[model samples]
Target: MRNLRYVLLAGLLGTALSAQADPVSYKLDPGHTMVLFSWSHFGFSHPVADIGITDGTLVFDEKNPSKASVEVTMPLSNLDTHVPALDKHLKEPDFFNADKYPTITFKSTGVKPLGGKKYKVMGDLTVHGVTKPVVLDATLNNVGPHPMTGQQAIGFNATGMIKRSDFGLGAYVPKVSDEIQINITTEGSVPKAGQQ
Candidate 1:
């Protein structure tokens, strides 16, 4: 009877520990993480540009996702619109002015769980030397062991919107569309033991 009581106590303690698991840190996989944006082109079409992520980190706690935080940095030179001419034009003083403001970044301020795997992440986004508050509607796609690397991994897809004028990137305004739709797909992994 004493042994049974001891077993019950142990089980309860284990359950509590599991319920309060510490947050895990993950390094963003640059090859799999990318930011895509699209905007209207003179009411003719919407052109999309792909921006590769340079580096980022994510802190996530599966049991308490609301405590999660993220920080990402991307270089303007990594922007690609498929057309070399257009890409070059975007980096000039007329658009992003990549020479002066070399990088864009986002840092989370708060996280709000919206039930299930959805969340609203509020953060400050810096672009072209301007900073503005933005909110991303994010969804957790999956969290498990990575098949190829055999490391623990997590993925998310998120979307948000911003105005070029807000970031001092408005060159054409209504002509080329001031509003841009931003889409992000990112994969993060826990480094293997003894690896940083």
Candidate 2:
């Protein structure tokens, strides 16, 4: 937890010092953002699902987009596939082991702009108590006025593929596809006071 606080503070500081005019901050909106992902079944079919972020933040560094950062913490136990029995098994030790590891998280270490609105985000992802480096291809959708308050909102699409075994999520190997593709459609909204 101390490490998390430190990284966040550092990110804020970088954003604060670099912006001669103003810094842009984005608070990931749980209602408007989601991480939808899927994995193949027996190497033939794909089973899709999604996880909601309980909290997250992002800073867009126009000059040094490489300095841009994103952080997210999600409740592992909340994972679902819209199927009751399957959901139960997913939470067991063979899968998420929700009882042992209550949370899954990601802390970005680097963000490199590919060109225009495309970027490559690299971070450490923790799942089932194992941490691994993951890279995602991200596309900035748009930035514009918020319909409700006119505050600026930023949207994005990011995708990555992970091998379940790499993260110790290798319970049902061939039964569950080894490679899982994660899709992130993130929309960042200005945070309200007392909301962070």
Q: What's model 2's TM-score?
A: 0.85
Off by over 4 Å in 1: 1-21
The list of candidate 2 runs beyond 4 A from truth reads 1-21
**What are the per-residue Cα lDDT tens digits for candidate 2 across 110-173?**
9988999999999999988899999999998988788878877888899999998998888778
Per-model TM-score, in order, reads 0.90, 0.85
At residue 6, give the lDDT of candidate 2: 100
- lDDT (tens digit, per residue) of candidate 1 on 102-191: 999999999999999999999999998999999999999999899988889999999999998998887888899999999999999998
Which candidate achieves the best TM-score against the true structure?
A: 1
Clashing pairs in 1: none
Question: TM-score of the candidate numbered 1?
Answer: 0.90
Ten residues in a row with the worst lDDT in model 1?
Answer: 15-24
Q: Candidate 1's error at 179, in angstroms? A: 0.5
